[model samples]
Target: MDPARSSSPNPATLAPLDLHASWARSREFGLRPDDALSDALVSPADLRDRLEANARLLTFSRPVIENLFRQIGCPSSTLLLTDCDGLILSAIGDTGFLDRATRVALCPGAEWSEAAMGTNAIGTALTTRKAVAVEGSQHYLTRNRFLTCVATPIFSPTGGIAGILDISTDARANLSHADALLRTTAECIEHRLIENLGEGFLSLHFHTRPDLLGSPLEGLVLFDEAGRLLASNRAARALLQLHGEFPQGSYPECFTTQWRHLVAWAAFGPLTPFPLRTLHGQTCIARAELLLPRAPHGRRQAKSDEAPGRAEAPPAPDTDPRLGHAGTLVAEWHRNRCAGPLLLCGETGTGKRHLLYQHCRDHGIGMPLLELDGRSLAARAQAGRDELEDALRQTENGLLYLTDVDLLPAEARSRLFEAAGSSHRIVAASRHPLAREAEGNGLDQATLARHGAHIVTLPPLRERTDFAHLVHRFVREACPGRPIRVLPEAIDRLRRYPWPGNISELASRLRLMLALVGDDSTELRPDDIPDELLETAV
Candidate 1:
C-alpha cells in the first residue's frame, strides 16, 4: 500500500474500535447524549479577529474547498473550515440548508471541539488527529442527531496541524465517499501551503506514478543546499513516514540517496526522473528544482595582484559623504585595486556607475575604460563564440564595465564569466541582488562564487543618514555660481518624503527647484516644492 494511504483512516468506513474509543472519550469528558447543543463559544467580534489572523491560511485553502464542493456538493449540505482549536473560521452551504446550519451554530465563530459541542466529526478529528466521520445518534449531544459531518486536519508545511476542512450535512443525506473527498482536498491545501512556504528552498516533486509528477497528488518536499529538509506537504511527510514537529538530519537520513548524488542529479539531469527510495525501501520517481545559492556574506580579502600600499582599510565617513559608511567601504575596495571581479548591487539611479568612475579616478588609473551593455553583449555572444572573444580582446588590460548584467542571456553569461576570468578586470552593476541576478540569468553557482567574490551593496538614498547634507550638496552643484539657500521648511519637507527614485530623483527635484528660483531668487521655500512631491510626501 502507498504510505499516504496506509497512514490515513478510510473515510468511507469508520473502524468499529475507533468509533467506540471516541464515544468512550466523549463520555469521559462528561458529555451526555441528552445534552442540548450550546451557543457559539466566541463572540462575533472575536470570530472576525480569528478570521483575520488566519487570512493567509484561508487564502491557500479556499480554492481546494471550492474544487471539492464542485465535485461532491449536495443540496442541504454545508462546508465548514475551522482552526486547529476547533473554532469555525468559515462556512459555506447550499442556500436551502444555510438557515438550518445557523440554528445549530454550525456557522463561523462557533467552537465545535468536543469540549464545546460533542463527539462530532469536527471535534473528533481534532481530538484524534485523524479524519473522522460522525452521523446521527453517534453525536454526543442529543440535539445534534440531525446532521452528519466528515472532517480532516490540514497539516502545515513544517508538519503541525494548521487547521481543519469539514463537510457537514443532514444526517439522512447519502455521503458515500465524503471521507475520501475531504482527505484529497486537505492534501491539495497542504500542497499549496508548502509551495508558498518553500520560497528560496529547493523543491522536490516525486510520485509512484510518473504522470503525477506535476499533479496535486505528487509529494512535494523542500530542502536547503546542505541537504537539510526545510518543509514538506502532507503527502510527502506520509510517503517519507516523517512525523512530529520536524524531521531531523540530512536528506540521506530520511531518503536512500546521498546528498552529493542528489545535487549532481539536480545540476546535470533535472528533467530526468531519477529513482528515489525511502529508508523503508519504498521506491518512486523524483525531480529536483535548484534555486540560486545565496551570496556569501562580507567581501573577500584583496588578491595578491593588488597594488602596493593599496590594502583595504576602514573607510572614513567623509570619503563619500552621502554614502556614509557604505561609501567609505567602497572607496577602500577601489583604492586597494582588488583583482577579483567587482559586483555593485543597488536599486536604479543609486549612483553605482558614478561610484565606479570615482574609484577609477582615485586610483589614478589611465587604462581604457571599456563599457559594454549586457543585453548587446548577450546578442553578440549568441551569434558566434568569436564575437564574444572579440569583445573580451577589446577590453584586454582595461576595466570592463557591464551595465545591467542581470539582463544577460544564459549563454552570454557563461561566456562572460569565462572571458572575465582570463582577460580583464570586470566591474559589473545590477539593479538586483547578485544572487537573484544569478538565478534570473541562469548563471552557474560556481561562476558567481568565483567572479563575484568581492561585492558591495549601496544603500538607497532614503536610508542614508546624511539626507540634509546630500540635499545641500545637490543644491550647490545645480545652482553653480549662484548661492541658493533652502528654507528650513523646504528642507524638512524633503527629509520627510520617501524618495522612491533615490538620489537621481533628489537631484532632479533640486534642479527643478533651482530653475524655479532663478538667479534673482536667493531662497527656495516650501511653496517652491513640486506639487508631485507635496502629494507623495509622507
Candidate 2:
C-alpha cells in the first residue's frame, strides 16, 4: 500500500471557517444554491495565452500529476491545473471520471472561478490564497455538491498565485490523501519555478535536516547580484517566519550569513552543505545554486587597441586578486606543496587548472605541466596506458595534472595511484570533493583517502569578493600599453553582473569591450558594457 494513499479525511473534516467565508462570498456574487453552472469557458485564443503564461507550471506539474494518478489509480478521480483566474488549463483523468468531468465542464479551457462555480476548490483556494477541500454538499453550487475537489495554489517566484493543482473525484469516493498529495505536488512545482528563474540569480536551498536540502521541503530563496531578496518559495517564507507579504529588504536582512560568503560557498556545489542561520536564531544546512548572466549572442570579434604578441608578465607569487578566499586557499595549497596528492575541487570554469598553472609559476616549480584526462583513460585502455605512462615519466621531476579524475575507471585509478606513490608530483581535479565522489561511485574510501587529503576549492566567479579587481585586471590586460580607464559606473555594472562563465568569460568580455572601443587611451563607460550584461543586473 502506498503511504500517501493510506488515509482519507472524513467528509466533514474541511474546516468550517473557510467554507463559511466562501459561502458568504458566493452569496454576495448573486449565486443562488439552485442556479445551474453557466456554460462558460475561456475562449480558445485566451486559453492559449493562459497556457503560455502557465507553461512553466504545466511543465513541472505534468510529471507529478501523472505520478499521482498512477499512485491513486482511482477511476473516479481527475487531476487539473488552472490559472490564477480559475480557468482550467490542463486536465487528466480516468475513464469513469471523464464523462462526469465533461458534463460539468471541468476539462481544459473551462472557467471555474467562484463567480462561475461558486465556493469550489480552485476558486476558494485562489480567493483565500490557501489550500482547500470542498466535499459533497459543502459546495455553494447545488450542481457541484456531488463532487469532491481539493486544491492548492501554486505560487509564482514573486509570491502571487500562478495556478492551481487540484484533484477532483466523485463525492462518494474516499480520497482523504488527496489534500496532502496536492499540497506536496504544488510545493514541488513551486520549488522548481523559483529555482529556474533565469540568470543572475543566486538560489539558496536550505533545511533543518541536511538530507532534505534537495527535496520540496527545503527552503528556497533567490537573490539578485546586489543581494536583494528577489523571491522565495513557501518553505522559505515559512522557514523565515515571513507573514502576509515578503518584507522589502536585502538577503542579509533575513539571514545571518553575508552575501559574499553564500556566493563563495555555493560555488563548491551541493556536495558541501554549509550552515546558514536566520536572523530569528534558526539554523539550517544550506547550498547555493548560482545562475550567472550570459551574453545574448556570440562574442564580438574585434582587434584590440594594443599591438599583438605582447608577452604578459608572469603573475607574482602573492595571489590572483580576483580569487579572494579561493586565492588564499590556493596560496595555502602552494605553501604546503608536495605535502601529498593535491585535490582541486569546484564547479567548472572556477580556475582549477588556472590555479595549477599559478602554483607552478609562483612557486617556481620548474616541472613541466603534463596532462592526462580521466575520461580518455577510462575510454581507451591501450592509448590511455601509453599516455599515462608517458605523462608520468615526463613529469617525474615535474607535475602531472589529472582532470576529471572522478571519471577514471578502477584500473586507470590503480595506475594513477601507483604513479602518485612514485616521484611524480600529482594533482587531481574534479567538480566535486573526491571523497564524496568515492561514495557516489561506490569506490573504496580507503583508496580515495590517500589522494584526497589536501583539497582546495576555487569559488565560482559570481561568489568571489574580488570581482571588481578582476574586472580591472582583465580590462587592463585587454588594452595593454594603452591608457584605459573603466568608468566607475561601468565598473559598478560589471560588478553587479554575475559572471557565470567565471574568469574566462570575464576576460572574453574585456577583450570584446576593447574591440568595440577600437581606439587608443579609451575611457570605458556604462554604454561600453555588453547590453546583455547590464540588462541582467538587478
Candidate 3:
C-alpha cells in the first residue's frame, strides 16, 4: 500500500490538528502566510558562493538526484537539495515546473526553514528528524498549497545530518509513492558516503545468510587498525540494534568471538563465513576484509632463483654482448659516489624498464620501486599540490621511476625536480634525450644537471645480437612445462622483421602463438604468425 494514501495513521505525517497546531506555532513565531516570497531569495552572488563552498557535497549527491529524477520526475515536478540549515543549494527539474517553483522562491539560495517558509517538507523534515510529506492545505503557508512535497534528511558517514533531498510536484499529481522513493535514495547516498570514509580501515560484511554477505542488505562495519570500531551502515546498525555512537571497544566485544581468531581468519586463507552472535543472542554470518596498504608502484623482486611460496617475477631480458655498453654505463654510475639520477633513453618496447630491473637485481639494491607516468603525474599536479607531495612522501628512501619524461608539463616537471632533490633516487626514461628536452624548456634543466649524469642509450631490437636467446627465454616463460618448437622458416621470418615494436611486441606474439598451440600441439609455424606481422615482412 502507498504510505501516503493509507487510511491508517502515517508515522511520517502529523494528525490534521497537529499540522494546524504547527501553523499556529509558525504564526506565534511571527511568520505570516501572506509574507512576500522575494524576501526569502538570497542574492545571486551569495548563491554561487554557497554552491562553491559545498562543492564536495554537490558532487556526491548528483547521482542520487539524477537517478530519482529519472524515476519519478515529470513535467510538473522539481527536485530541491538543501544544506543542513535548509538553505537551497540546488534545484533541478522540468523547465516549466522550475519556473513555477521560482515564483514561490523554491530556487537555489532560498532559505526554506520553518522561520522563513513555514512548515514545508524541507523545514519539517529537518525539524522532526524524519521523512515528511506535506501536501496542499497541509502546508503552513497558503501560497504553497498548490504543491505536494516529500523530503528526507541525508546523513553523513559520521552520523551527522548532511543535507536534505526533496521532491516537489503539482498537488493534483498522484505522488503516493514519493516518500518511499526519497527514503531509498537517501539510504543509497548514506551508504556511498560510508564507503568513501578513509583508508587503513577494516570492513566487516555480515548477514543472516552466507549468500547475502555482499548484497546491498548486508551490514558493513568499519574498524581502525587497532581493531576499534569506526562507523557502520544502516544495515549494520539495525542487525546489531546499535544506537548513537559506537561505544569504545574492540570489534570482538560485540560478538561471541575472540580478536586473535578473527585476525587469523582475515590474514591466513580464503574468506569463509564465521559464526557470530550479537549480545542479544541473534546469530549471524560474517566475513572480514582487511584492506591492505598500497605497495610502492612498480616494485618487484627478482625471480631468477625461485623458492617455494614466493611469487614469480616477470622474465628478465637477455644479457647479450650487444647490451654490454649499456651495462657498463650503469656499473660506472653505481660505482660513482655521487649517486645522482640516471636517465635511460630508448625507443618504445626496447626493454628499458626491464634493463633497470635487472640492474637493480644485479646490484642488490633492496629499495622499493615507485613507478609513475610523467603525463599522469602532471595531471595530478594540476589537480592539487598535495597529491604530488603525497606521492613523493610514499617514495622516500626508494627508487622513483618516471616513464615518458618528455610528456610532463612544464610546471609539473619543475615541481617534480624540486620534490626529488637529493632525497630519493630517480631513474627517468624517455624516447628522446633529457638534455635536448631541457634545452627546449620542456623539462627542468636543474633536474637534468642533477640526475642526468649518466644517460644510457639502449639499442633497438634491429641493432641487437640477442634475438635467438630472447625468443627462447620468452617462449619458455609463456609456455611453462611445455617444449617450444619453432619451424626454421618461422625463425628466419621473425629475425628478418624490423621489430618496430621491439621486445615487448615479440613477447606478446609468442604468448599468442602458445595460446593457439593447445595441449595437443607444441610447434609454432609461420602460418600461426599474425597476418599483420607477415604483412610487414622484410
Candidate 4:
C-alpha cells in the first residue's frame, strides 16, 4: 500500500477539540502541535517512522534544495513535505517566511489539505495526478494570493501519491527550468521509492525527449506486474503520457511519458526487425531490443570456430593472439565444473590476468569479476560485519581475484580472507607459494587451503615446447596480410636462453624485432636477436 493509503485519505478533519485545548494547557504541548494531536490519538512510536527520517524532513529545503532552486533560476526556494492526509509533515525555507507561515498553523498540522485549502499547487498537483505550478492569484485562498508554488506529487511503491514536493518562490522568479526542476523532484522521490521496494521492474523516463539522454526532463517510473503500482514513480507517469495511453495490460501511468515509441514500434514491426527511430506518419514503428538482462546459460569463453565434432558446445573463445593457450583454459574451465575456483600460478608475463577475464565473458554467473589487491581489501574492512557486507554488495557473487595476496600486509591477511568468504569464487594468486606467508601472518589454515583448489602452474618459457609455437605465432601476426618466418638458428638460441620473464618477454622482443625489420622477407637469425638476449644466453 502507498504511504497515503496507510494513513487517513483526508486531513480536513480538524484535531479533536479536547486535544486542541490540551496544547494550550502546557508550554511543551503548546510548542509541539504534532505531539499534542498524535498523543491524543495514539503515540509517536505507533507511527513507526524513525527520528532520523523525521529530522531529514525538517530541513527539506537545505542547500541541496536551494541548488535545485538555483538550477531553475528561482529567487527563493521553500519546501514542504506533507503527510498522506495533506497535513504538513515538515516545512523549510527562508527563516523569516517559514517562521511566519508556521505561526498561522500554516507550517504543519493546521491541514492545508486539498479538501480544506482547495485547488492550489500542493493540493491540485496531487488531485490532478500531475505537476502544477499555481502562479500568484491562481490560489483559491486569498492569503496564498501573492505566492507561486510549483508542486509535484511523489508516489510510493503503489501508484498512490505519497506526498507533495513543492518549490514555492515568488511568481516573478519562475524560469524556463521550473517545469524540469519539478519533474526532477518527482524523479528523486521515485528513486527513493525503488530503493525501498528492493527489487523488481523499474522504468525510467524523460519528458523533453527520451532519446536525448541527460535532459533535465529526466524522471523514473516503477511498477510490479506483481503489485498495484509497484512504484509508479514520476518518470514512469511522464513516459506513459508521452507514449499516449498505455497498452491494455499496463497499470496506470504514474509519473512519466516514454511509452509512445515503444508501443508504436512493436505494433508495426511484426516480421523483419526494424530500427526503433523509424517513423511512419506521426507514429513510430520499429523494433529496439536491449541486451538481455539475463542470459540463459553461462557465458562462453571462446567465440571462435567451433570444434567440428563437439555436439552442443557453443562457439569457441575469443582469440587475441595475446591470449593463446590460457585463453583456451578460461573457456574449458567455464564448460566443465569450475565447481571450485581456479588458483592460477604464473609469472607476470604468463598472461594470467587475461585468462582470468575470459571467465567473465563465458560464465552464467550473475556477477562480473571484482578485483582488489589483498592489502586494500584488508585495510578497508573495519569490522568483519561492515567489511563483509560491503564486499558482498560489490562482488555480487562473481570472482574476487586477490592479486598478489602475498604482498598483502601481515595485519590484513585475516580480514582479506574474511571479506573473500562472501564471494562465490575467491581466486588468489602469488608468484611465490602463498602457503608459507599464510602461516607467518596467522591466516586461518583452512581458509588458505580452500583458496588453493585447482592450482594451475604456468611453466617458464624455457620449459614450454609452446615457446616455439609462440614464436611462430608472433611471426605470423607481425607479418599479417603478408608472409614472414622465424629463422631456425634464432629459434635455437631462444630455446637455449633461461628466458627469466617467460612468454611476455619473448612476445615483446619479437614485436620490437618485427618493427625494426619492417617488411623484409629474410628469416631472423642470431644476429637479428636483441644484444641483451644474446649476452644473457651466450
Q: Highest TM-score, which number?
A: 2
For candidate 4, lDDT tens digit of each residue in 77-129? 56767655565665566766666554434454445545555445676666665
Q: After superposition, which runs of candidate 3 have C-alpha atoms over 4 Å from their true positions?
A: 1-21, 44-49, 209-212, 245-253, 268-273, 292-538
Q: What is the alpha-carbon lDDT of model 4 when measured against the actual structure? A: 0.48
Cα TM-score of candidate 3: 0.50
lDDT per residue, candidate 2, 129-148, as tens digits?
A: 88988888787777777898
What is the number of residue pairs that collide in model 1? 0
Q: What lDDT score is found at residue 460 in candidate 3?
A: 85
RMSD of each: 22.5, 17.2, 21.9, 21.4
Q: What range of 10 consecutive residues in model 2 has the weakest lDDT sum?
A: 2-11
lDDT (tens digit, per residue) of candidate 1 on 1-538: 5332233324445454566667667667776666665666588788788988887689778755765676675879999999979999988879878788888888888888887776788988887878988877666676777988889998877766788888999999888777876786787677767766624446788876553565456888888877788888767777887767555455887788887777665644344468898886888889875553222432222122233343222123332444555557666555554455677778877878778766654554444455555655555554534555655775565557777776777666556655554336677777875553345564334666765445777888778776766776666555544556666788888887878778777876676567666678767788888787767767
Query: By summed lDDT, which 10 consecutive residues of candidate 1 come out lowest?
Result: 297-306
Q: Deviation in angstroms for 405 in model 3?
A: 50
lDDT of each: 0.69, 0.71, 0.68, 0.48
Cα miss at 119, model 4 (Å)?
23
Q: How many residue pairs collide in each prediction?
A: 0, 3, 0, 31
Runs in model 2 deviating more than 4 A are 1-14, 268-270, 294-538
Error of 3 at 178 (Å): 1.8
lDDT of 3: 0.68
lDDT of 3 by residue, 461-482 (tens): 8788777667767665555555
